[model samples]
Every structure is written in C-alpha cells, then in structure tokens.
Target: MATSESGSDQTSSALSDSFRTPYYCEENVYFLCKKLSASGTAAADGSDLFVVFISNEKKQTPLWNQKASKRADGVVLWDYHAICVQRKKEGDTPLLVWDLDSSLPYPSPLTSYVSETFQPSFQLFSEYQRFYRIVHAPIFLRYFASDRRHMKDSAGNWTAEPPKYEPIVAEDGAVHNLNEYNEIHAADVMTNAGDFLNAVFTQRLGAVINENQLEEFFLKMP
Candidate 1:
C-alpha cells in the first residue's frame, strides 16, 4: 500500500466519484466516526464489550506530497486518521494510541505492491492534534501513566512517580499522556497525578476549559 504524508481522506472521495463504487480503505482503515461525530455529540458506545475507541478520527487517505495526495496504485486515495481504542479502561489515558485496534499498526499504508516495508508509528493520547484536544475538557481523555522517575527518600518500596489517574477525590490532579513511552508503569502512577495535570493545564493551556464540562466528562467515563 502506498501511504501519503498527511493521510487525509479528501483524495479518497474524489477517487470514488471519478471511478467506481465499493472501494476499500487500505488495511486497518475505517469510516465509523461519521456514525456519531458528524452531529458533534461525539457519543461513543462503551458497552459493546470490546475494544473502546478511546481516540479516533474518520479513516483518511494518505498524502503523497505537500499539494497533492495520491495512492500507490496512482488511484488518488484519501481519508485517513488515527484511533486509540482498548479493552481495558485503565489503558485509556493521555498517551497516544492506534486507531480502532491498539495493534492496528500504523505507517502501514495501502501500497501498490502490498508489501510491508515501512510501518507508521502512532499512539492514542499523545502527539499531534490528539494531544491538543485531549488537554481540553468536556471530553474524557484517560491517561494511564506518563512519568517513570520517582523519588523514594526515607520511605521504602517502589512508589509511582506521578499520581492522579486514579478514581479517588481530586483537586487539580489528573494524568497526562506521555509522548516518550518505554513502559506502561510511568503512566500508571496515581496520587500526585491529578494535581500535577491541573498545574500543567493552568500553566500551559491557560483557561480554555470550563471546569464543569471537564468534571462532567470524567463523571461519565467508565
């Protein structure tokens, strides 16, 4: 499969109209996002008893270059996006993830030869536009762990470096997605997590969020 740079779906639509119907997105591509997001509610179903779409965008076509995006077969494909979904709720967090299935394997663009030479790398919460939107509230962005370095002064045992991803009462405390992830342990820590996130948001994001919407978003999170 030939992958594009930006991976937008605009090119794909043009292909369908110019060509025939019943075309397919490259491997691991989908268009389910329009089911709920087109209206803007972004309502998702968590009770289906499978991988949850923690993060995702409509499936898109890869961009071949700056001005134009075409397919490896020269079909001019379009419509592409990343998605982060998982079976475990704890896995949802500030980190970036793959679309649909966590193991969907990115960089795996539709190629003309259909050979797996280059693979894409992406996570759910961190990186690109996902990071920007996750920090904003009115939506639940579950963060597992992001940091690993912790200090255990006079105390004993392995303590979670950053805390706040947990479900206990919180005040300026939450989790954040880590772009540089080596192990899952870093984002799994709690306690100081929520408070830490509050600080980051206030200091960096300013006041683009409404506390009520943020709280309500989390409240509905499972």
Candidate 2:
C-alpha cells in the first residue's frame, strides 16, 4: 500500500515516481488504474477506479497546484487533463484522486483535490469554465486509445516526446480514439443530477458534468 503523510506537500514519492510521465496525463492514469486494480487496492474487477477528465469546449481549463507550472501559484492552463479516482467499496475510505501532474498530495482526497485544484469558489469566464467526463476505469482501460497525434504541430514535428512504450490501442483494435474521451459538448451536459449519476457508471464514455457538480457527483457515487 502507498502510505501518505497527512498534510504533506505531495503524495509519497514512491507512488509518483512509479507512475509519473511528462505531458501524458491520460496514459499515466491508464497505468495507474491498472496498478490499483491489480494490486487489489481497488475492487478486484476495477469498478472502484474511475477516470475523471477535466476540460471545456475551448480546451482552456485552468487548474492550480500543477507541478508543470512555474508560477508561484502553480497554475497551468491545460487543454485537457486526466486523473484516476479511486472509490473503494470496502471500509470507509475517502474517495481519492491520483493526479501525477499535481503538486498536491498524491491520491489527494476528492474534496481537497476539488477545492484546491478546481477552486470552484473562484469565478472564471464562461470560456474558461471547466467540465468533467467521468468514465469507469474498466471501460476506459478497454476503450481508451491514444496515438498522441494531438501533440504534433501542423509541421508534423513532435511537440513533446511521447512515452518510449508503444501508443495505447483499445482492445477492439481502435487507434486514435482519444477525442472520443476528451471531447465534451455543452449540449451534452446532464441537466438531471440523478440521470448523470446513473449514466456515469454505465456509459462507455461516461457522463459529462460541469465544474459545480464535480465533487458532488463523485461523492454521491456508489
């Protein structure tokens, strides 16, 4: 088990060191879910693991306390970001978020991760407002494929080096289906909270919810 010190600046180095990768949050999270599921920290079938993608129609979501930021406030404007959320079914463990890019503690409690990272109290322009796509880890793992094409410029040069490992391909042999998971539309926002909760676990792409509903959405998860 990865142990964390209360109020530590970051999660135990061991966990982060094992999973951290630069500019590949989605892939980093894919393997993190695998670790949690295989290690038995999550449910044996991995139902306890969820992938929460944060972004907006503009792909201009601003998040704070990200390790990638050089600013004193540790803020970074991301096109999209991904994190692993663990909601164990066993004894009352708080919902935990594993963000490899965050300066916040590794596997931070969902509440703290939301309050500090999302800063819902802080107002933002409509274009900068954040949206979340919550996908079950099992479904995400099986279907999430990324060719890393988005990282390239029009010139086809590598904007950032990709992982040395081969790109992820879905079990069904789909390549470059990343947009299916990263893209969120304003029209798709679930108006009924009850319907959103139920759809999140059942749908392959999961459900899209706005920033205000983020913490509450996960808190209400089974």
Candidate 3:
C-alpha cells in the first residue's frame, strides 16, 4: 500500500495514473530484506546506494495490478516512455521498468534452456540463454546505459539519443520487444535477493553469488 510522506530531497513527487506518485531514492541495500517483509522493503533513505521508487499503495491492489504480461503473466511490465525521453537528455540508456507481484510464485522463464535453480555455474552463457524473460535482469540494463553514453540518433547528430528495440518472443512465450523500459521483478531480483538474505539470516543453502562471480558470468555473455 502506498503512503504519503512529506517530500524530501531524495523524493520526487508527481502525478501517475491520476494519483500522486511518491518516488523515494534509497540505498541499494533497502532492496535487501528479511523474509517477512514482502511488500514493505526498506527505502534508500540516506545510507547506501540510493534506490529510487514510488509506492503504488493508494489503490488497494498489487503494484502490478494493471494487468499481467500476456506472454509472461509472471512478468509485471512497466512502460518507461517518459524515462526514455528524459534519458535522451542525459545520454543515459533508457531503462526497462516493472514491479514484481511476489504474491505469486512464477515459473522460471529459462526452465527450457537449462534445468538448474540459478547457481554460479549457470552464469556461463550468452545472456540470452542464462537469464529469463525478455532480457537478462541487471547486466542488460547496465550495458544499455553504457551503450547509450555515445549513441547517435538517425539524424547523424549525437544528441542524447534513445534506444531502439524490437520485441521478440522467447521460447518461454515471454516478449522482449520494447525500449525504454524497467522491470522490478520478485522472481528475478528479489527471489534471489531473499536467497542472500536467507543465508545472512538463517542456514546457508547454496554458495552466495559474489559481485565478481556475477560480473564474470554476465561478462562472459556475448
């Protein structure tokens, strides 16, 4: 459920879906949470890599209440048209946006590619093969931003440019056919996020994926 807090330096208040949107920039750590806090994770307030977001609680529904992605009902998609326009100004790569509905457990979109719960070894392949859905979780976006740094539009002018994307259907029936988007997934981002937390809070199961391991994994992707 969304809340109304007085605006702060880290927040950007605006209109979205006809209601006020409260975007909070929080530390990346806020993305981490104990197993109990499903809908109410911590915000980036001031201490860590500030992650920014708006709570969509004004309406009594899941943040992804609009409708599920037809191809991947498991995919809570976000249309980042506005962010695309803005990114063109900063020469930043446009982002893909969507919030996950943890209320349900989604089947792994990559189940067909290989049969293993995500593990360190799974990182060794083209990103397309390793990650689920339309795109790989974070590396794709990071590369996108990197690519946009010096992008030039069709005008032959290097004005801050937006990316161009063509959606294609994956074997999982998920679609990857857009640009300027963001997906906040419980399955991809937090499902494993919780794995890390579980290791920290309770008994460790699998070896945790370190940043270097992740880097090697994604970098190995073509």
What's model 1's lDDT at 190? 25
Error of 3 at 67 (Å): 5.5
Summarize candidate 2's per-residue lDDT along 1-222 as a digit string, tens digits: 344324333324555677667999989999888876776566877888889888889989899999999999899999999998887555444688889898886777788888889887888988898888999898898888999998899999988888888899999998888888888877778979888877877887999988778777777765
The lDDT of each candidate is 0.25, 0.82, 0.23
> Ten-residue segment with the worst summed lDDT in candidate 1?
47-56
**lDDT of model number 3:** 0.23
Candidate 2 clashing pairs, residues 3+ apart or interchain: 11-106
In TM-score terms, which candidate is top?
Answer: 2
lDDT of 1 by residue, 82-183 (tens): 232222233223122223221223222223112221112322232211111122221222232222223234565434232323322112353332222211
TM-score against native, each model:
0.19, 0.91, 0.19
Q: Which ten residues in a row have the lowest lDDT in candidate 3?
A: 81-90
lDDT for 70 (candidate 3): 46
lDDT (Cα, 0-100) at 28 in candidate 1:
20
